[model samples]
Target chain A: MTMDLLDDLNRAIIAALQENPSRTNKDIGKKLRVSEPTVATRIRALEDAKVLRVMMQSDMRAMGRPLLALVDINVEGRPPEDVATELAALDACTSVSIPMSNPDIFCNVNAVDGEDLQRFVDDHLSKIEGIVSYEISTALEVVKLDPRFGKLRGE
Target chain B: MRLDEVDREIVALLKEDARISNRETARRLGISDTLVRKRLRRLSESGLAKITAVTDYVAMGHTTTALVRVVSAPKVAREVVEEMAKFEQISFAALTTGRFNIVLLLSARSRREVADIIHKHLRSWSGVHMVETLELVETVKHRLDVALVVRDK
Candidate 1:
C-alpha cells in the first residue's frame, strides 16, 4: 500500500502499538477513539499485507551475546548472493544484506565475547570462498536502538 | 537472567506468536497458565526480553534504508553518536572500533531525506571526519531469535 493509503488512523494505531506492543486492541481503540473491531481489522490487514509484525525480542547484552560485530565483505569469484546465504546460515549471524553501494555483503554477528568473535571470523568467515577482503567493526556501545521502524514521525 | 528449559520454551512460543494468550501458551507447553504468566512477567521485568512490534520499512513507505559508517576525530566518536541518536530517522547508532568509529541504520521516506541527513546533519557535525553510506538493496536475512544466540549460564 502507498503512504497516502496508510491514513492518519492507521498510523496512529501503528504508533500506539509501536510505543507499547503489549497494548490490547480494546486499549488501542480507546486511545485512538475508534471501536475495538476497527483496530483489530486494521492490524490484521497490515499484518496480512506483510507490512507489520509483532514478535519477542531480547537484549543482546542480557542474552549473553554481549559482542556485536558489523562485517563488510567484498566478493570476487562468486555471486554476492551465494556468499550472503552462507553467512546468514551461521548461528551467530543475525542479519545479512546486499547493499546498493560498495562492500558486496554486510552482516551483523553476535558473540559471547572477543574470543568468540575472533574464533567465528577465523573458523566460519574465513572458509567462505568468494570473500576477497572483509572488515570487522566491534561495536563499543549502542547509543540508541529503537526497533519501532513503523513510528516514522519520531516519538 | 539465565533462561532454563521452560523459559526457553515459553520464549520460543512467544517468538512464533507474541499475541498468544497465556492460557494457550500453557496448553501448548503443557504447563500451568499461572507459570506462563509468571515467567513472562519475570522476563519482561528483568529487561531481558520483550514482545514488540516491528515493520518492513519499505512496506511502511520508508523507501530509503541505509547503513552509514562515520569516522570521527579522536575522543569524539561517542559524543557524535549520542547526538546522532536523537534524530528521529535514525533507528540504530553505535560507536565502534575499526575502519569506522560509528555506524548507524536509518530509514527515510525518500533518498532526499537520506542525503539531507548525511550532508546537513552528519557532515555539519564538528567532529565527523567522513561519512560513507551503503544503501541496502535487499535483506537476505533478518531474524531475531534470541534463543538461537543465547549462551548457557
Candidate 2:
C-alpha cells in the first residue's frame, strides 16, 4: 500500500465517523457535499491503508470490570520487549507497550474485583521471570480521551 | 445502562462490523430495523458504547507516540491537567494514583516534535515538577471493551 496523504474530503469523512461511526456512506457524502461513491471509496482506502478503523468500544466500568490499572514493569535480568510480549499474551492484559524511557514496560490490565487483581499479580504478572518490580497506578478518572485519528484541521 | 439480550446482540454485531446497516442488524437479530436503530442511538447517547475511527499512528505519518508521566504537587494536579488538555497532540490524559499524577498519550511526526511538546508546551507549567516521556515501541492490544465475544446464555 502506498503512503497516501490525507486529503480534505478524507479528513471530513474521518471527522464525521469520529462523531458517529454508524453513519452511512450516503449520509456522510450528503453532509460533506461529496459523491456517495467517492465517500465509499475513500473509506475503503483509509481502512485498507490502516489509517482509519471503526470499532465498537464498550465502557469497561459499565461492563462491570471497573478495576483499570497501569503497571510500569521494571525488567531485571531479561529484555523488556520479551517481557512485554509475554504479558500481552495474557487474556486480562488489554494493552502492553515497550517504553523507551522511565519504566521498561507499561501495561494496562483490568480486573473484576480485588481478588481477581490479586490472582492476576501473584499468579500471572509476578510469575513472569524477568520482572523485578512494578508500580501499579489505578486510573482515578480520565480527564480527556480523544481517540481521533489525527487533527481534524482547524481544530 | 444495563444492556438487554438484544442490546448485547447489537453490540456484538457492531463490534464485528461497525458499518453494518441497521436493517442487516435487525435481520440478524430477528428484530425490526427501527428497534435496532433506537437501541444504537440510546447506547451511544448514554456513553455506554462508542463507535469511532481509531488510526495506526505510524501509518498516519506519526513516527512517535509517547506516554508522558507527569509528577505534580497534589494541590495543583487538577490545574496541571487542565493545561495539558489544551494540546491537541496529547490524546489521552488521566489522573492516576502512583508516582505520577497525570499520564498523557502523545503522538507526533518525529522525536523533535515530541520533545517540543514536552519542553515548550508541557513542562512550562510551574506546578509540574518532573516530566518523563516513554516512547511506545508497539501496542500489543488496545481496545475499550472487556472482550468482544458475547457470553453464551
Candidate 3:
C-alpha cells in the first residue's frame, strides 16, 4: 500500500526470487502479509529493469542431454556476428556471444548425448565460413555455475 | 512485493540455510506454515530465485579444471562457440571485457586429456589466435547476498 512498504517488499521479493526463481507471488505475498497484486507489481519492475529473468533449472541429463559445451573460435576473415547468428540457429545452442576481439566468441549449448559432441563439431563449427579453427571442451563437472554479472559482496 | 518485518525475517532465515523447510521457515518467521510455503512458492516462480542442489565438481572424476580464453576472427568466433557448446566436458562459457574475447570453464581427467583437447579442438584451429588457461584451485564462497540481512552485526 505505502511506497516504503512497496520498496521493502520489493527488496524481499528480489531476495526471495534470487534464491528460488520458481516461487510464486501468492506464496511471496502470503509471507509478506500483502495482496498478490503488490507482489506482482514489484516483480514487474525488477523484470523491466532487466535485473531478473526466469528459466527452468532443467535436468537435461534426465532426457539424455549431453554435456555442457564451451567453444572458442579463431576466425580468419569471417565476422563474429555471422558466426553468432549461425551458432544461435543450432539445435543445441543455448546461448552465444561475440566478445570484443577480432574473432573469439563464446557459446554454451546442450547436446543430446555425449557422442553428439563430435556431430556438433563437424556439423556446426566446421560449416561456418572462414572458421580457421575451433576449440571444443566438454564439461565433466560443473563446480561453480552462476549468472550474476557482478556480485557485490560486503558486510 | 511489499515486504514487512516478517518478510525480512524470512529472508534472513533462508539466507542462513536454503534447505530450511516450510514448517521451519514458518516457525522462524512466526508465520503459518501455509504462509511460509506460499511465500517460498511466490519467490521461486517469480524468477527471483530457486533452491537447487549444487555439487562440488572436484568430488567427481574431473581432476583438472581451467578457464580458457580465446582470440579469433569474427566468423570463427561464432562457429567456435556453437561447437564448444556441444562438448561433453565444458559447462560454462562467457564473453567478457579484456585482451581475450571468450572464456570457458573446462574439466578433464588429466593434463594429457587437456592437451589433447587443445591439440584436437583449439590448437589446430586456424581462426584461434591465443588461448590463456587458468586452473580453479578453490571456491571460497558463492551465493547471493540478501539485501535485508545485516551481516556485520
DockQ of each: 0.51, 0.45, 0.04
Scored by lDDT, the top model is 1
- Which segments of candidate 1 are over 4 A away from where they belong? A1-8, A149-155, B145-153
Which tens-of-lDDT digit does each residue in A1-155 have in candidate 2?
Answer: 43344877787887798777778898999999989999999988887666777777675556676777888889989988788878989878877887776688889878887788788999977799899988888778767665554322210
In candidate 1, what are the lDDT values of residues B71-135, reduced to their tens digit? 89978886778788888788778888998889998888988999998998888878888899999
Per model, the share of native interface contacts recovered reads 0.74, 0.71, 0.02
lDDT of 3 by residue, B49-78 (tens): 344322223322355655677777767766
- Which stretches of model 2 miss by more than 4 angstroms? A4-12, A19-23, A30-33, A149-155, B144-153
Candidate 2 lDDT over B57-95, as tens digits, reads 655677677899999888888877867877867767788
Model 1 lDDT, residue B134, Cα: 93
lDDT of each: 0.81, 0.77, 0.57
Q: What is the DockQ (computed on Cα atoms) for candidate 2?
A: 0.45
Clashes of 3: 57
**RMSD, one per candidate, in order:** 4.5, 5.4, 16.6
Lowest lDDT sum, 10 consecutive residues, model 2 chain A, at: A146-155
Ranking by DockQ: 1, 2, 3
Ranking by lDDT: 1, 2, 3
